[model samples]
Target: MKKTFSREGVDLAYRDVGDGLPVIFQHGLGGDEAQVADVFPDRPQTRRLTLECRGQGVSGYGPVERLSIATFAHDIEALADDLGLGAAVVGGISMGAALALRLAVHRPSRVRALVLARPAWVSEAAPANMKPYAVVGDLLMRHSPEKARRLFDDSTIAAELARLAPDNLSSLQGFFNRPDPVLFGRLLVAIAGDGPGVSEAEIRTIAVPTLVIGHGQDLVHRLADAQVLAGLIPPARLCTITAKSQYRAAYRREFRACLSEFLETLA
Candidate 1:
């Protein structure tokens, strides 16, 4: 069922499912709880919780000015505390992965382990900003799904999306459909705001066991960043999946296998 909590006076929405060790799944930009539902269909012993970050999903957006990773981390902590969870395994995809890393760095005690999927941040190399591209992509989606498909299909980003499993592809398509130009533009600004990247020093200090999943052909999050992340974290294991026509189909088995193995270590 979905639940609500107040963090720093801002309302946050989350979903709690199954029953076992607590595992929090944070979605990337423009994502919500359904993304988690698609990726993880059966977790026999994991109490999975997917968070809808502020400005997305059912979560209410407070002052857009205060939207930052630090604040999001704070809200995550608050949610965990409210649920009486301590040191839960935390993970995310894309920008969500970046926030997951931030939690590991800033609130080390709150995260028992880490799972990052197609993480967006690398050490020093700046990925080509895809905000403008995504904007155009979103615009195209409004006018023509064919153009949207064509534009993204030809690009590396489309390949990444296509690589996902059929269900995941559908979920992603739903997410893309929900994009509001004004909301998306503001979210883009927030993501591109002050804290654009994480420091190598901070990453090295993370002591929690980490699982890094990367797709070799991912256009949004480069493989180089994943390599740097794997190299920096002492207790990190890196796994790369081959790029497929669809991200879900191409990496579904590999991602599940890797995540299952990593979760077993924590068990």
Candidate 2:
């Protein structure tokens, strides 16, 4: 079922599916609930709740200056509270993972477990100015779908893009066009901003068991970062999948298998 909850005067969209232990799925920047559905479809015993962060998908955006990791974390807390889910397993991909980590740090009681898929915030070399792409993407999103598709395809981590199928590629392009252009730009800024620092100090404080998923060929969020993250968190496990090349195959099978195993252990 899909619903909306007000947070700081903006309405955020979310979807809940299946039935079991609550599991919240936070999508990456410019991503919506569908991304989570595409990744995990058969976990019927796990009640999945996927949220569309502010300025993305059907969610309404607030002031552009307010877009940041901390604000997003608060939005997640509000969504969880509205759903009557006091504590749930929280996991995310890319920017979403960063938000999940922040949620665990700030609202410890609300997160039972964590799953990070190709987390993209730990790098120091990420571009500081996203204005160029944001302007281009916003224009393409409204006027040129083909150009937008090519832009996204080219921007994806080369090793990861090689793994995706044609259909998955199409789905990704569709997602890019679903959100508002202005809001998407703000989301881009939010993603590029510094994320939560889950260092040894912070990791040690995290009581929840965590799983870090990485691809051997992912350049954006290198395997080394995953190793560092796993090493820092006492109860964390690292799962690495070998990718033939970027877009080679979404590594769907490996991702699901690893996630299932990790969740099973949580049980």
Candidate 3:
């Protein structure tokens, strides 16, 4: 069932389902709980909890000024505290992966295991890969939604992404079609420009078992970034899954298999 928890005056939404081996999984930018459900394996023995971050999904925007990865990480921390979970398997996709990594670094005691799926950032703020998102954000800020979509469709960025990263291109298109493009644009700009805030040295200090998933054909979440993360954490295991653009079915299957395999090892 869906639940709501207040954090810093914002009513954030969350889900606590199933009955054992609590796993705190999260969704990416412009994603909601349903997006997580699509890839998460269905198991009777595992309970999953996903908190919709501020300005995403059904969650309320709590102090819009505080939209960095650190803020989102703290929201997850607060969710864990509210649920009385001292430590659980923490993981996520894209921006969600960054949040999980941040928790593993700063709140190590609260992460039993780490699962980073399709990570987009490594150590620095505003990585080059995220430039497309910045472009979309700028368009939303500068022109009307219709005009922005028209402009983006005709831009070189769109042409390049259509040929190289169809999945990323599709996601960017969704931004133009959103009901609140302005708000989402601000969110995209803030988050795309923000990094995990945890340095490489700090990442090396993470002592828990970690699973980093990455694939090719994805410009936004590069496989190289995932490789770097896997190399940093001592117990991290790197897995390369099928790219979604190559085959959606295989991608989901491989994603679930990787997650299930890692979860079993933790058992």
Writing each residue's lDDT as its tens digit, candidate 1 over 142-261 gives: 545445545544665445555643332443455345445445445545664424246889889988889998866545666777887899999999988764334556567777777778
Best by lDDT: 3
Predicted structure 3, TM vs. truth? 0.97
lDDT of 3 by residue, 1-267 (tens): 789999888899999998889899999988999989999987768989999998889898766589879998999988888788878999999999999999998888899999999999988999999999989988887889999999999999999999999999999998887766777778889999999998999999999999999999999999999999999999999999999999999999999999999998887
Question: Which lDDT value does model 2 have at 188?
Answer: 63
The TM-score of candidate 1 is: 0.80
Strongest candidate by TM-score: 3
Off by over 4 Å in 3: none
TM-score of 2: 0.79
Q: What is the TM-score of each predicted model, taking all chains together?
A: 0.80, 0.79, 0.97
